[model samples]
Target: MKKPSRIVNFLYRLVGMSYVHESVSEVREALAEHSVGTVAERWARIHAQGAEKLQHPLDFQPGLIDLHDEMHDMWRYLVALRNQASRGMSAHLADELEEAADFMGEVLHHVGLAAEATIPDASLDRGPGSTWINIPAPPAL
Candidate 1:
């Protein structure tokens, strides 16, 4: 199968990176609010806001559907944790929260790799449509 052009790959990676950033920020906020005993209604609001924010970027990259679902699952877990804490059922939640944070870090690392892979190598010659221009330096004074 023919590989996608570098431009296409770069666009996909850029959009994916944006989605990952938004997801990470939302999860971090949710986790912080949960730790502070935020109410269930507030959690629901945050969930809706995060979903809305991610919808467009997620649509840009069809390959990330699974990741999008995983994000929702993580958000649900955070909301549940908040509910549990509110009910005085806190037990090992700190550990769970830490795990979630670690998972997000891993996701960020992977997405960063995907984005980085598309960057043009500095040592490679620019192909067709390259805009780089080399001008000879003026004679030394």
Candidate 2:
């Protein structure tokens, strides 16, 4: 019955489960500098990678975070993978994005199942934990 917090909503968008208006011009903007041929090639390659890639089974245990700093590693690895793909520096994502998205989805899913649990389970922190560092929000364009 409760709505997702702002932080959870941000995660949703990050994993491509939600839509935002700002990125609507993404392809057009990309084409501004690169030619149609280059864009086409990259798009095909990305889709190919998505299909051909075999993501290893995620090691997410339970609850919000793991002791191995999996959340931070997932974020860092995903950004590096995306950056590499974006720059055309590397097509292999190492399945990091899928892993990160799965990790985040596990977090959200854990918080979500709280309501369905037979016993009370309110101990979960639905957002960033106390040990998690704070990063200032980026300046609005």
- The model with the greatest lDDT is 1
Candidate 1 has a TM-score of: 0.27
Estimate candidate 1's alpha-carbon lDDT, on a 0 to 1 scale.
0.53
Which pairs clash in the backbone of model 2? none
Candidate 1 residue runs with Cα over 4 Å from true position: 1-88, 122-141
RMSD per prediction, one decimal?
21.8, 20.3
The sequence of per-residue lDDT tens digits that candidate 1 reaches over residues 1-141 is 243465876888888732232465667875775666547666667656544543333232332445555765675676566566656565566556656756765675675454334334635736554233333332232
Estimate, for each residue in 78-116, the C-alpha lDDT of model 2 and write its tens digit: 666666665655555545565665676576556445323
Winner by TM-score: 1
